[model samples]
Target: MSADQKHFSPPARLLHWLMAPLVVAMLFIGVGMVATLSSWHQTLLAIHKPLGIAILGLVSVRFIVRLTHRTPPLPNDMPRWQQHIAHLSHWVFYALLFAMPLVGWSMLSAGGFPIHLFGPVNLPPIVPQDVQLYALLRSAHTVLALLLFATFLAHLGAALFHGLIRRDGVFSSMAKGRD
Candidate 1:
């Protein structure tokens, strides 16, 4: 591939850098939400719900951008297994991006709770209310959140490996738009 093709498109990089911190904050916020019984719980819930919806929307757009554009290729010298792992990890990130909010929304729906985004703009429930369903979805959402956090750490480690250790362009492909 040409040098240009070896770098991620501008939009892709923008979405990536934009989402990274938001996702990290969301993870920490999630932990706080579950850890506290104080008044802060409601505060965190308010932030968590809206932020999750935002992530879902952004990820949907990001997925479209990804599909429409060609991504930078993995290094030729990289092991085949590593390449496969890299690809799988990306798909997993996409899956978690899409899954986390939907599950949260569905969990709320199952519990018959309102997803208040702002005044008069609440999200309508997608599932009928059921205590059993609520329990199941709540558990699923927690598990998915944990998985997303793990994947995020692995991705960050890989990027550091390529950038700091290997001195490869893989990290720069996403970190910088050009050579």
Candidate 2:
């Protein structure tokens, strides 16, 4: 693709869309996990913890790939405010992507729980078990997840508004492999 033509590198595009659904699932599960009781709740916790770590792994790989690949710039005529918002939102997404998993892992580690990544291999706990700390991190994890969900909605709304109303290629840029 020409430098002037807005487009996503194939890997970036794939990773972007792939993570969208996973992150949404993680957020839903995070919320749902809290409301349940008994074996069902435990099952969701098992899935939520590991799945979140998986998303973190994917986000790390995506970030590295994005760094290695250059994305075309926003349309030259795009307004400064819109451009600023887009940039800020993207960074916030990354921040949450990095923070949520780390907090969860830290919480587990501090709580003296192993991180089981859907495999027999067990991850050693990071922090020594402490009830007070565990409670604090647990709350932090949930709150951050909620914040991330809201930011994600705002991001999606902006993309749709830009793509459908502004008729800009902002949304298309992430999935141009089909377009």
Candidate 3:
């Protein structure tokens, strides 16, 4: 209800939403690439691998900016429990964002698959093929993706909870920055 609070810095706002589409897109592409195995497999991998790497790079920059820049504090009126949930959810997002790509890369590498980025660049493989480990990592990575989706829903619920019930600008702080 007050007009005195500051909004997120422009860069933080930009990256916040900018990363959303990429994450969702990567999740879909990743699933497609994993579910199919045939002539088209390599083609999909070519597209998916680079895109995942690119997302990882951008998230890295966003994390740095988030740490170094000034983010508007939670509206003072928000409950302490809500603030704690927000903080925990944010860290969870960061972890999943980072883990998904790394695990994918490791899974592929462990399968003796080549990682071809957008062009000539090749990502270094983390391990040699081990049938058992590849299966294990693939399962873990899939579970993490599902967790990301769940956390994402929780994040949305909180945002709506704030923007509607609380009549606060918490959602707007990030949403106001148009992609």
Q: Give the winner by TM-score.
A: 1
For residues 1-179, write the lDDT of model 1, one tens digit per residue. Answer: 79778899999999999999999999999999999999999999999999999999999999999999999889899999999999999999999999999999999999999999977889999999999999999999999999999999999999999999998799999999776
Ranking of all candidate structures by their TM-score, best first: 1, 2, 3
lDDT of 2 by residue, 1-179 (tens): 46335777888988888999999988888878787776788788888887887898999999898788877688779889978887888888898999999989989988888788776966777778898899999999988988898899998888888789988777787767544
Model 2 ranges with Cα > 4 A deviation: 1-4
Could you tell me which 10 consecutive residues in candidate 3 have the lowest summed lDDT?
1-10
For model 3, the stretches where C-alpha displacement exceeds 4 angstroms are 1-5, 34-43, 177-179
TM-score of predicted model 1? 0.98
Cα-based lDDT for every prediction: 0.95, 0.84, 0.81
Error of 3 at 67 (Å): 1.0
Give the lowest summed-lDDT range of ten residues in model 1: 1-10
